[model samples]
Target: MSETYHIPVLRDACLEGLNIRPDGTYVDVTFGGGGHSKALLERLDNKGRLYAFDQDAAAAEQAQKLATYPQFQFIQANFRYIGKFLRLHGVRQVDGILADLGVSSHQFDTAERGFSIRADAPLDMRMDTAAPLTAAEVLRTYSEAELHRILGMYGEVRNAKTLANALVRARQQAPIATVAQLKAVLEKHAPKHREFKYFAQVFQALRIVVNEEMGVLEEFLGQCASLIRPGGRLVVLSYHSLEDRPVKNLIQKGVLFGEPEKDVYGNFYKPFEALHRKPIEADETELAANPRARSAKLRVAVRTEDGVR
Candidate 1:
């Protein structure tokens, strides 16, 4: 098997934000390559516990070489069911939660995964390879209107209408199969830049759909409110502005779904304490080392007695 390198982004920031307790329980909700988990484990004593969740089984293969430790447990499941997975492990609340959201370098670099537009892979962009839906299925099955809306909203492509129409017309002639095939069909729809922001957005949208990313994130965030202990930190790194916007609003306002409420004492009851008003970005050094950190926006919040402030 080929070794896949999964570089954890904002490593220092995430570790600092976690404020890890040596003997405290922690959860790595998106344990892509065990980068953060290894760091967390190194800080913990034998008594300290760490649980990791990843729907993709392939994501866990990297850390199999670690010495057997009772304190560390890796679960093969979606982070969306964090609550359920933790329950099975006999865990109720955790001291910290780390979520590194976005496609892992391993996934993008692997041609078979169909995440990178540069690779001539199949149109199967499921982060969790076991996931039922693939990009090809969506492209071939979804109505042109649905495709247009996905590109417009999720991808934020300016020429979504033209692109969707092109895709629809192309599919009628021949079913889209590989990345290069799809690229060829939509070449006219993309901007002057071939491998720049234009195609990135389009690929992002397809990955989001294949993985059901936004929905999973919403579910996972809501679970964090209940899964984290008071004072436990919730740290997330989102790559897309669309993904970061919701996290920012949810962390600061503490109200994700409904209007905010205030008690008679004029003190609002919030579930979490927003660590910073704005999301943090990668520093110059980290960015230079890893261009993936360029789009990273890190958000940190502490769980409060009441939901996120």
Candidate 2:
């Protein structure tokens, strides 16, 4: 019932990074809490428009509660399908694109959402409630081998195999329904001193798979160069290495495919130009204010027309 603690990460930096124009069109790919979208709208003029997408129904409701802005339009859909969603509204070009990826504070603090390992709630980490695969279903249905791969590849858990085998074995005795039950299985496999961070990774890995985040990010970034008008900026705030690594690689080297290629002329031929060589880390001020921002890594890129290949 109280105000959610979304506290947009890199607020000033994101806005400045986008180089917001008074009458330009913009898109907030992840409109969690509508904090960034509202901020963007406030900076826009009557002619300006901001089209924000959030798959979560709760987030769309949050956007509805905001002070009415004529220039704001909220869409309830995944950003990966952004190309189709924007096209329906007859939108072709945007001045800037912003995405604040990963689970939000509201999702974590709210027990029913079951995102945080700290709380005991139903293992339903779907950002969009309509999403068919819930965390509980994943744990309850997945093979031990499949579970191990996700935990290892996504969460970077050290003993993923042990953890996966334990999950499947434990759930067989009783279906894993809540975060507490799942943690009980993972706790035995987790290290003694590093239990919290360790378990958090396990949960993070499950959440990422349930949401298909890596695939979603890939689709969203693939369209960015074409979506944004030339010279328009792309600002992203990724919370973990899994998310940041792709962003870093894409910004430095346009294509999200395999490794970069070398040419006879020695031209790198990257599609995007990095606004900053290094990722922007949260300052002590921001970290102290919101510990969630501690892991936030922001990368900005500008669209280039040169790399058509």
Candidate 3:
């Protein structure tokens, strides 16, 4: 893997959370740069197995570098289907599963990916190049209300409704097909001096909707409880609150939404228990080396016996 593909965030903390066993089976659902997968493989023995999943073709290409490792295998698909793919590989359960969510550094830095506000590229922020939806399509076809919801819910943009209306009006005049075109519309409404942050928020909203990230994450997490053996770990590194919330809920409440239901005995049922009350943040040392690590929040959970059912 190219060193610049991505720098794994909270690497040591994630490894420690996994508490790897040499002969155990493990999975890295977002094997972006294969940095975490490569590290996991190094700690495993011949009997151990590692299954990695990545929807991005670029990441799949990066996976080639680790193809020599007999213990490692890569699945070029979104992790929403993690259970289906793992079962096809004869893996019904694993000792640990690591999910590093959100866009990778390579995706953001690549000018053509349209993930970064810093560059002017086609509005194609599809994490999987093969995916049908693109940011451009979302902007061009989505209703103003649909746009408002995503902008507010996914990106937490303050003027989502206003912006959504503006987008609809602007697209009527001409298609907002590129980052530059979209930014031209955004510049009109963006708060002075905070234009960059505002642009990033809007981009994040569009990217999430285009990729169906939150929905995919919920599906993937739903499978995790059943796919991890009792005592196994689930380590997730989420970059934003939208990604972190479900992980927190699943670990704490054993459900994606709402509070955990109480059993007949009046005790709440939970599949996994959080290893820490608070999400772990990158240390000063790591932040100094990789500024991208600043927003990362690592959460680890252990599957309880209840998860096996």
Candidate 4:
């Protein structure tokens, strides 16, 4: 595994949550750097199989190293199509699924990928390079209203309206094709002592929109609910509330949006049982070593054999 690709957060917690059976099939939906996948494989015996998914070319290149392991198979595709891909591979259900939702550390460290605020790279934040829309395209083509909505909803940017207007106004004179260009435009509106945080939020908003992260996450979670067998586990590690909220709701309530329906007896039906009432966070030891783990929230659930309410 490439040390720079990504460091799995809450490794032990996630493994414990999965409760792996020695010979059961498992899937690591976000196989960045294969850290989690490697660990999962270590726990599985010869009869066990591990399927890993990734869309980024860089991650795919890195995954080739794991190919020598007979128990391992790598699928180069976005996890949003996990169900389709699994069915194509002759898999109907899995014993466990693990998703580490952080954009890989390597993606941020490689300046040209444009996932970092500290870099001066071209505004391209597509996790899947083949994807049609890039961050530059989103900024250039999206309307002021669209920009504002994404910034507000995805990034929680405080002055999304002002920032959106500023971006539109700046683009009128010249294209905002690079991080440096976008930073300059936002500098004028950034609050005192909060410029870094503001830039981070803006970039996050653009990346989310360009990647359609929220929609993809919803689809993946929906598939997880259906594809995990009874007593199987669904383990997710989300780096932001935008991602964590849906995972938490879907696992506990069986619905991605709105409240879960209740029976005449006033009891709500749950498809999975939450293993941990509160999300597991990185310990101080891990946090000190990996600052990225600070924002991570790990949630786990086990599929149940209950009837509808």
List where candidate 2 sits over 4 angstroms from the true fold.
Answer: 1-5, 261-269
Descending-TM-score candidate ranking? 3, 4, 2, 1
Relative to the unseen true structure, what is the Cα RMSD of model 1?
2.2
Q: Under the 3 Å rule for N, CA and C atoms, how many clashes does model 4 have?
A: 0
The C-alpha TM-scores of every prediction are 0.94, 0.95, 0.97, 0.97
Q: For each candidate, what is the lDDT?
A: 0.84, 0.89, 0.92, 0.90
Give candidate 2's whole-model lDDT.
0.89
Error of 4 at 222 (Å): 0.7
Model 2, position 132, has a per-residue lDDT of: 96
The residue-by-residue lDDT of candidate 2 on 77-171, one tens digit each, is 99999989889999988999999999888888888999988878999999999989999999989999999999999999999998888888898
Candidate 1, residues 19-71, lDDT tens digits: the string is: 98899999888888788888888889978999888888677776574447678
Worst 10 residues of 3 by lDDT: 300-309
After superposition, the stretches of candidate 3 with alpha carbons farther than 4 Å from their true spots are 307-309
Give the local distance difference test score of model 4. 0.90
Q: Judged by lDDT against the true structure, how good is candidate 3?
A: 0.92
Question: How displaced is residue 304 in candidate 4, in Å?
Answer: 0.8
State which candidate has the highest lDDT. 3
lDDT of 4 by residue, 1-309 (tens): 766678878888989999999899999999988889888888999999899999998889988988878889899998999999999989999999999996888889989989999989999999999999999999999999999999899889889998899999999999999999999998998899999988988888988988888998999998886789989999999988899989988877788889988878888867788888899999899999899999999999999877254
> Is 1 or 2 the stronger prediction by TM-score?
2
